[model samples]
Target: MADIHITIHNKTFATATEPTIADFTLSLVSGEFVCLVGASGCGKTTLLNIIADLDYDYDGDIVVGQQHKSPKIGYIFQNPRLLPWRTVRENIELALPDDYAGDVVDNLLDIMQLTPHQHVYADRLSLGMGRRVSIIRAFAVNPELLLMDEPFVSLDPPTARQVRALLLQLWQQRPHTVLFVTHDLREAITLADKLIFLSANPMQIISEVLVAIPRNERNNELAVENFRQQLLNEHPDIKQLL
Candidate 1:
């Protein structure tokens, strides 16, 4: 039923199923932007760690279909995590693999309008700028799968919105398979191609709701509100989580 299919089953020592994610199955089409939303303590970060193989105890099957070569992974954490002493461009350079394209960082910087700040030290930039640089670092390596763990959670609403728009622009330029985790319904609605809801404790996927509203159309506040209402109406269970 999906192009990018994954199955997970975990037997934890602590007998905790919520953050440990006992039983779960989810799938998505290639190049899809998937948002994983759940309650505050519902294993969202745990699940992402499993996906990145940072957690090894779990047993799961992951199929990414066929590709010419093994896919590289890019992970964006809650903080920008850029080295304080490194320049913005230097931070990106550090992430570049031997096979990285020459113009990759420059192209990313140009579109994010971060070229002017490329020479600035990581600590010198604003929070929003730091987040953008983190994003660029992820893309610089041309990763096949991008895992974002609430990269914009710390920013103010306005700053978060701006980063989201910039993220959209980057995604459109070269679509990468992205798994973004967030607790905010509005942010999830703004970014996701499909929504994955999870149960409270065990963190099993309760539903997969497609956001059919066109991305361009979702720019308007009223349109987003209307579409959200439609989502709530069709999938009333989401109301509780929201």
Candidate 2:
């Protein structure tokens, strides 16, 4: 299998000539975690939509690296998107592929420390817990490529930290390819091995920085703070929180 490559010539709004994302290209090796960042309304979600095949009007090439002719892709949006009537386990189970036969849902719940809540209705779950179910639902497909669009956006600091830990634990166990988008620089620094920055509206990638810290060291407050400092030192404009 070759590396996953996405080449976007342009994406538009009213007409083909009025472009949003123009000439953006990204490549991902198997099991790598990459994060995308940009100013709001810069078409980051639109780019993700194109990759997930939810939008097809743009001119681009999405080349998959896996041996399967069609790769399995799962997405977790800003909202949980769970069925209020369904149980936590049932919510995740619904995303499993038809041929799947293993205890995937049970295992994901176990690792996320959510097994006890398995039988509860989705509507009854706390915000953090509900988000965990959304994550489990995405991983239930055992996706070859996972796309996340600021899934941690609205959570409180403590809850967001816990959820991030759960996500890292799952990634460590399964090691699937990941493409995540976020507005928070610290969040990106905490999770991504590669960080991509996009320009304001004609959305184009302006810079890419590789995080050199070991994955295991990323969660330490001191280490993360130091790395965060380094990012600020290197890109003072990032301090503006664009």
Q: Please give each candidate's TM-score.
A: 0.92, 0.93
Candidate 2 segments exceeding 4 Å error: 15-17, 66-70, 237-241
Among these predicted structures, which one has the highest lDDT?
2
Report, for every candidate in turn, its global Cα lDDT versus the true structure.
Answer: 0.82, 0.85
Distance from true location, Cα of 155 in model 1, Å:
0.9
Q: Which tens-of-lDDT digit does each residue in 1-242 have in candidate 2?
A: 24688888978876546689888888888888999987778789998888888888887788786442335688999999999999998888888766776577778899999999999999999999988999888888877789999999999999999999999999889788899999888889899989988875678877788988898888887887898789878887765446
Cα TM-score of candidate 2: 0.93
In angstroms, give how far residue 26 of model 1 lies from its true place: 1.3
lDDT of 1 by residue, 59-107 (tens): 6666666432223578999999999999999999998766767587889
Worst 10 residues of 2 by lDDT: 63-72
Residue-pair clashes per candidate: 1, 0
lDDT of 2: 0.85
Candidate 1 wrong stretches, greater than 4 Å = 11-19, 66-71
Alpha-carbon RMSD to native, per candidate: 2.6, 2.1
Q: Pick the candidate with the highest TM-score.
A: 2
Clashes by residue pair, model 2: none
